[model samples]
Target: MQTSLAKSVTFNGVGLHSGAPVRMRLHPADADHGIVFRRIDVIGMQNRVHATWDRVTPSKLCTLIENEDGVTVSTIEHITAALAGCGVHNALIEIDGPEVPIMDGSSAPFVAGIRRSGIRFLRAPLRAIRILKPVEFKDGVATARLEPADGFEIDFAIDFTDAAIGQQSKRLEMANGAFVRELMECRTFCRQADVDHMQAHGLALGGTYENAIVFDGDKVLSPGGLRRPDEAVRHKMLDALGDLSLAGAPILGRYVGNRAGHAMTNRLLRALFAQPDAFEYVTLDADQERLLPGAGVCRPVALAG
Candidate 1:
């Protein structure tokens, strides 16, 4: 069955890149609405931005979506991940600014909020993109691929020059609320040099040690250090799930990402959808539904962890 939130939930915080304060509300929508973002502050322009891969623009820093009228919203991956992770398919996300909040640089707050609001199941049967064959996209050292699988799985590998975060890899079957329990709290991280470079260019204005994990040479700059030793890679997996959610449906496949980012993942989606033989849409049966990412997700219990 499809699902929507039981009630509206609101969040307030600053954007990691723009540093602008924004308030966003997630309202339950009718079945099959998927996910749409409304720019409440815009006037005289189309304010609706569909959270789809086709709407994705080329961005190095974040996942951005723009409507035909040029209304855009940035840094949407975290909240998007939370929605998909919680199995909320029909939502109208309203934001009063150009970017979603970077609350704690993780999807924990969003997950918590959704859990509090609860999810209501609809009568409509759920549909998912089932991978038919291997589809892959690559750029230099980065690559992302999807292949036929019984359920959604994620495998990620990240290598960084920083000694504190050299090389890490992890693979997880995203069933059974694994996303919320194991991955949602992992925050975005960067090296001190990258932070300095972005700051010199007047970017990441709202970024501070409090919001993101920062590392310098061999020292950890963020207070209390990392929540997980391999947080960098786990966050990468979190990002992969969010970007893949742009498919606009729950995907049943094994996703493998190697040093892949937003742009690369979007390209992978483009490649997958462009090839008709690569995938197919199927209505899930009751047993198949149990294996989907949203199935068996103990929202309240997962959030507690």
Candidate 2:
């Protein structure tokens, strides 16, 4: 069955890149409404942006989508991840700004809000993209690939020179509330030098020690360092899930990323669709539905101890 929120949920915060204050609300939609983002602040142009791979614009920093009229929204990964992780099929995200708020740099706040708003099942069948062949995209050292799998899975690896986050890798079956328990609270991280560079360039202006994990040489500059020893990689996996959600349906495939970021994942999606033989859309069966990321997950749980 497809699902939608039972009521509206609202969020307020600053955009990680723009540093602008924004108000966003998630409202329930009818079945097949999919996920559409409306720019409430836009005056007259087409304000509705569909959350789909084809709508993604190239950005090295975060996932961004634009409507035909050139209205765009950035940093939407967290909330989209929350929706996909919760098995929501349709929603209308209304935002009075150009970016979704950073919100502690994690999806936990979104997940918690979604759980509190509750999920209402729509009387319609759910569909998923089933990988039929391996599809991969690569740029320099970064790579993103998708291959056949019985259930959704994510395997990610990251290597950085900073001693605080040198090398990390993790793989998990993202089903049965695994995203909520394992990945939702992992915060976005960046090296101190990168933060300085981005801020100098008028980007990541809203990023603070409170919202994003900051690494300086061998030290974690964020307070209460290291939620998990492999948080950097886990967050990468969380990000991959968000980018994949842009596919517009649940995916029954294993995604593997190596130093991959938003752009590479979007490229992989383009590659997958370019060759129709790579994937097929199918109405999910009971067994297949149970294997999806949000299967049987009713409420958010406390972070693992």
Candidate 3:
């Protein structure tokens, strides 16, 4: 069965890059509505932007979506991850600004909010994009791939030049609330040099030691260090899940990424859909539905310390 939020939930914070104060509300929508973002700040224009891959604009730092009217919402990956992680199929996400709040730089806060508000099932049958064949895309050292699988699973690998965050890899089946429990709290990270560069370019204006993990050479600069040893790779998986959700439906496939980012993942999706024989849409059975990422989630355990 498809699901929506039981009630509306609101969040307030600052955008990581723009440093603009913003508020957003997640409201329940009827079944089949899918996920849409409404730019409440815009008037007399098409304020609604579908959270689909085709709407994605070219961006290096985050996942950004824009409408035909040029109204855009940036850095949406965290909240999108939370929505998909919690099994939310339909929602009208209203934002008063151009970006979602960078709450703790991870999906944990959004996960907590959704768990608190709870979820309600709808009477519509759930549809899922099931990969039938392997689809791959690559750019230099970066690569992303998706292949047929029984359930949604993610495997990611990231390598950084800094000694503090060298090479890390992790693979997990995104069932039984694994995303919320394991990946939600892993904050976004960057090297000290990158932070300096972004600041010089007037980017990451809201970034501080508190919102993101920053490392300098061998020193850990982000206050308490890491929540997990391999947090970098885990956060990459979190990002991949969020980007994949733009498919406008839950996906049943195994995703593998090696140094892949938003643009690479979007390209991989384009490749997947371009080959008609590569994928198929299917109505899930009761048992299959139960095993889906959004079905077996254990909210309490997911948010527990």
The global C-alpha lDDT for each of the candidates, from Candidate 1 onward, is 0.90, 0.91, 0.90
Model 3 — which ten-residue stretch has the worst lDDT? 296-305
What does candidate 2's lDDT look like per residue over 227-277, in tens digits?
A: 999999999988998899999899999999999999999999999999999
Give the Å error, residue 84, model 2: 0.8
Clashes of 1: 0
lDDT of 3 by residue, 4-59 (tens): 88888999999999999999999988889999999999999999999999999999
Could you give me the TM-score of model 3 versus the true structure?
A: 0.96
Residue 204, candidate 2: Cα error in Å is 1.1
Query: What residue runs in model 2 are displaced by over 4 Å at the alpha carbon?
Result: 299-305
lDDT of 2: 0.91
Point out the worst 10-residue segment of candidate 1 by lDDT.
296-305
* Candidate 3 RMSD to the real structure: 3.5
- For residues 67-116, write the lDDT of model 1, one tens digit per residue: 99989999999998998888888899999999999999999999999989
> In what order do the candidates fall by lDDT, top score first?
2, 1, 3
